[model samples]
Target chain A: MVIVSVAMLILFCMIYLIPGDPAAVALGPRATDAMREGLRIKMGLDKPVWVQFWNFFFAAWQGDLGRDVLSDRLVATVVMEQLPYTLALIFGGISWSVALGIPLGCWAAVERGTMADRIVGVLSVAVIAVPSFVVAIYALLIFAVALRWLPAIGAGEPGDIGDQLVHLILPSLAVGLGWVGYIARMVRASMLEVLESQHIRTARAFGLPERMITYRYALTIAILPTVTLLGVGIGQMLSSAVFAEIVFARPGVGKLVYDAILTRNYPLVTGAVLVTTILFVLLNLLADLIVGALDPRVRSRL
Target chain B: MTVLSIKDLNVTFSTEGGRLHALKDVSFDVPERRIVGVVGESGCGKSTLINAILGLLADNGRVDAGSITFEGEDLTRLGPARMQELRGQRISTVFQDPMGALNPVLSVGRQMRNIQYRSGRSRSEKDARSEAMLRQVRIPDAQAALARYPHEFSGGMRQRVAIAMALMMRPALLIADEPTTALDATLEVATIELLRELQQDIACSVLFISHHLGVIAELCDDVVVMYAGEVVERGTTRQVFHTPRHPYARRLLECDPARQSGRTRHLPTIPGEIPDLRQRPPGCVFATRCDQRVDACDKVPPDVAVETGHVARCVLAEAR
Candidate 1:
């Protein structure tokens, strides 16, 4: 709740910080001063900044974020329309990253100091070092343009699950690839540490199969930090998804916010920021719950 | 008959400095249904001996030349599958830190069940056996205790649970590596007592390792005294504690606070450092620290059999 409020205030402050008049942006340079002033008063920009913020904050509490100045549609509706695409992209990215990262991590740790471990170490560092936007562009060029495999632009036709899924692959890859390296490196480091821990030794001492010890005993404990990283990674992925969306020309809340910022669409921008912040907080909460379930020590504390 | 026998064990670790002679020509036997304690200071290679026996030595460490014979099989030569099969069912271990020995995330029941993974028993049967073992170790509310995490238990209780898990399969041999060192003084005695009672109940041979001489003296039937990486003395607890033949053994016993006759400002300490194990010493490992060192002490000491069962690795023992 506190985070949402803070994010809301920051978003409002951002509206003021950016050098543009929504009325002028909406009416264009041809509009007279008298007409602009009338438009500003109607849009509540004529009121004190605090008053405008308080009115918005009060209305936001009741699920009212006004409407988009350009389209005159409810800000909530516009954000909601774009939310699913961003969400699908984020979730798809996270799923593949975890699938690839965890096993790679476990394998690296098990074969530590060997060629396999070294390869994973080098690859993970390399992937993590490269910026997501660069990956986004290259991925677009290769998978979408050069290879002619996936669609290069747009989010595909709406109401078609198959089309949406096909469109989701490259953007998800661009957003999630870095996280794969991040998760792999995190899991590997954590697994190495856990494997050295006394409990792991105890398991080995008891004559448990090496496979069981690695997966059941070591991985369970090693994966805790990775869970936390995923929560934070999602938020970062949402932001980075903007680059993928812009390059891929996909419709998403991130792209919506970026376009809104350009046109000085205050209601839409604030509404999208608020919704994503809430989503980030909720995802983190889920991660904490998962951690608690996995680790009884954490559960007991909770 | 011996339940576990380590003969001519030569374990070394590769470090940045050089190859560390952590254990050299070390040999001992854990006789059936007997408790043999190995006592030494930190870095005395007690842990290395345990790891070697369990075949869980660190990647850089190896058994260069050794025969760890458990039952009729040479364990050092056993394949990983065979070693794993023998573990928990035939040989089990209780580690030093009770808190660390058990997985914190798992319930006590879950870990105990895991210990019996090779049993091919039903889950309920394992749970029932785990509960019974907990009761044997005197953990209150044994059934409920199984569901609780290690952190929920006090240190002593956790150690008791560790003991229960170790003895659950009624392993023929149990290796306890300073299991009571992490507990409080009162709890340590209680844990030792519980271990002895459980050992007797299961009739398992135990190779217990500790630096605590008092604990060894109280609980062990036979005792091995180690200095640096080599065993300096071995005998019945009475023989070693009452009549330690090696100078290092005598100094170690004298350093025990309980053995000191009266109060003094200074605690008795052997006045020298352990020789660097990266380079194996040609002479007695403890020769530099021995107050009774003679010209012959500069040579590798012979194993002098003072009695039928008592042996001391010192030239003076033979002279005496």
Candidate 2:
């Protein structure tokens, strides 16, 4: 809650500092001076910056993020409509990354210094080195343009779950591919460390099968850092999702903010950023809670 | 009858320098229901010997030659599956640091149940067995203790839990690798007593390894002294302690703080380090450090039998 309020304040300040009058942007170049002045007063832009901030902050605290200048609709309603798409994309990216990353990490660790391990090592580094936007562009060109197997643009028909999921495949892949590298490397390093621990040796000494020792005994502890990484990864994915959303032409909170920023839609941009920050903070809290549950030493302190 | 016999075990580790002969011609036995202690300094290959017997040597280390024969089977030749099957069922181990040996994320009951993975018993029955073993180790409120994690207990109690888990299956042989070295003086004695009591109750042969000569004298029936990967001396605890034949074994005993009669500013210590294993000396391993070294000591010393069962690798063993 504290983080959300602070984020709102900072967003408001930054948007205010940006050189462009929202009134002029809304009115266009042919408007007379009288008309621009009238529009500025109506949009609450005539007040001092501090008063403008107070008004915006108070209204936002009461669940009102002011009205969009061009559309004349509530910013909160606009954000609510677009949030679900962005959330789905972020979650899909995270889900697939975890699905692919963990097993690859465990396999590489189990086969520590072999050809398979070397291949995974090289591939993970390659993916991480290439930015997500570059991946998004290349993926768009290959899958959508050249291969026309999937849809090229839009988030599909609004109410059709199957079409939206199909459209989601490419964007989520672009957003999540790099994270797969991050997660796999993290899991591999921690797994190797845990494998060297005395408890693992003791487990082997007691005659547990190699499979049980690797997956059950070692992985349970090794996956802790990866869980924490997932929380932070979601925040990073949100920024990457903007590129994915724009490249794929999907209607999401990130694309909404991107369009609003171009049109000087301060209310919409501030509201969307504040909401995403809140969600990120909550997701990190969830990660910490999961770690506490998994490790008893952490649980006792909690 | 021998519960476990290691015959001419030769193990080496490949390093950037060269292949380190970690254990060379090392051999010993744990007779039925007897406690055999291997005493040596830090780099004397005690751990390498244990790893060899358990087939748990590091990736760089390999058994160059040897056979660890237990019962009617050779452990060196056993496949991973068979070796795993024999581990907790036929042979278990208690490690030096109890906290490091038990998983911190798991409960005592969960780990105890896991150790009995081969039992093919139901969860409730396994829980019952775990409680029984904890009770045998004299852990207070053994039932409640099972639900607790390893860090929840004090150091001594955790060691007790490790012992309980190790002995739950009534293994034919138990390897205790410096199990008491991590505890304080009082806790060390208590842990040793608990281990002794548990061994007698379970009627299992124990292969104990430690540098504490007094602990060996108090607990073991026989002792083997290792120097630079070789078994320098072997005899009954009485014969070896009362009449040490090998110069290294004799020097090791003299350095024991418990054996000193008067207060002195300087503690007795063997003057030289163990020989570098990367290039094994052609002569006796202890010759450079031996105070009574003669011209003949420059060659490989013969294994001289000073008595019926007592043996020492030294030129002067027969004379001494």
Candidate 3:
């Protein structure tokens, strides 16, 4: 934990040293030296880079990210208010992918030579081959604009969670579809290897129900590797939700970071990136602990 | 009453390459409390025959023509769901390698209890029954094993768990496919001894598959010798082993590395590859490897009765 704090301090220093002026990037390059220097002082960018970094770090440690330059509100206020919409999509999207992909992948593995297996195999390959951007746009064009079934953008009336869900559907489907294919194919391969195992045959020999053999004996073992992949996929989703945020016009970290980057709001941009990196690391650590708990060998060792 | 009677059984498998004749016109009966040991080379379809009996053959494989009548119901005609019901309750199997035959994730107790519960016992009743069966199999630390997964148990201990699980429902027939193959010499002897003791206690018919003639010699009352998918000899263990009438059986017993008296038991080599299932010789699958093969052996499929209760599928045995 101590090492982590020290590492973060180093990372902050290194990030600040990147070429180009925050003042020039924040205001346009057309600004004179006097204007740049004056703005830098006000923003605390005129301080030694370490001082500016420490000022932001202390504020972040206190759970106050200062204010968004343009929004003129606390960054925490923006994030906490906006996070639910993104998280709803992330949670719903992941739940749908696992529920659908696991059984589908198991069936595909168990019935390898059948038409259903071949069709699913081909579809998984096809979905993965196509980019998430293409799927999101096409879905939005068809379901939102073309049919008018769903609102094309906006998280809906700020007070209504149900309306927010309706708004999130298209973008979630878009992101989930890309990852589902890769996950399904990987699960199928693992399931295939496990189903042929002698333990599975022994389970069959014992006259356990077909479902028991397929799920308890076979699928349970096959799912461990997929569980690990799901963790990696969650990280993938956050990084890639930029497209989703843009398409849905949702107020989330993705959009906030994009805007911050464009306007060269150095503190806000750095804060967003730093938060994302920390979240990514935390998610990985949490997944590792979950997997270790699920696996008896790891659990016992720990 | 007979527990399993397989008559004129033939199993064929369809592969991308061609039709594979995995089992050819094989027949045998496993009576109540009797032990039937099937000895053969690896590819001679012993495992396939056992799988066919269990109705667990691969998608491409099928019992092409056969009648497996167990108790009163013809197992060959039973629906899959019904077959599954019969499997654990009335018929169970002990697989070849204990390491490969047990689920690594499950505690031995859970695996044992699952079979009992699945076969219609209540959870509490199932737990009692499982513990009792483990004791019956003579597992010294069965209670501790119950908390541990397959990885924690030794190979021999794993086999004991398997045997206990197989006996959970007191199945009428137990198909043991090379159950000792994964164990060391001492454990092999010990496991078969435990199995012999099990046969006495529960009195269920056990069909043992093995490549070792020595094991069959020790355990089975009846021995079935198969070569290239065909049962070349079948008889009482005494008649078949001592007064072996079939030349293939003779050559097989001769090739038994651990059989002959004296230094290292002189493991004799059979001098030919076991014929491929997809490309078996027309008249005799073993004739290619037989030293005493005659033209008549090449032309005719041999089916000879050596005694009223014993049979040998060899033309020479019937010539007299």
lDDT of each: 0.90, 0.91, 0.81
What fraction of native interface contacts does model 3 preserve?
0.72
lDDT value, residue A37 of candidate 1: 97
User: Which TM-score does chain B of candidate 3 obtain?
Assistant: 0.95
| Cand. 3 TM to true fold | 0.90
Q: List the residue pairs that clash in candidate 3.
A: B257-B267
Residue pairs in collision within model 1: none
Per-residue lDDT tens digits for candidate 3, residues B1-320, read 88899999989999988999999998988988999999988788888898888888888888888899999888888899899988878999998889889887777877877776555667777777777787788877666667788877778988998988887787889889898998999999999999998878877999999988889998999999888888888989998998898888988888777666778634778888887788877777778888888887777566888786578887778633
Q: Tens-digit lDDT track for model 1 on B42-119?
A: 999999998898888888999999799999899999998998888888899999998888988888999899988888
Kept native contacts, as fractions per model, are 0.82, 0.89, 0.72
Error of 1 at B189 (Å): 1.9
| Model 3 lDDT tens row, A115-201 | 999999998888878777788788889998899998888778887878977887888887788667877898899998998888988
Q: Isolated chain A: TM-score per model? A: 0.96, 0.95, 0.87
For each candidate in turn, the TM-score is: 0.96, 0.97, 0.90
Q: Is candidate 1 or candidate 3 better by lDDT?
A: 1
User: In DockQ, how does model 1 score against the reference complex?
Assistant: 0.82
lDDT of 3 at A78: 71
lDDT of 2 by residue, B90-160 (tens): 99999999879999999999989988878999999999999999999889999999999999999999999
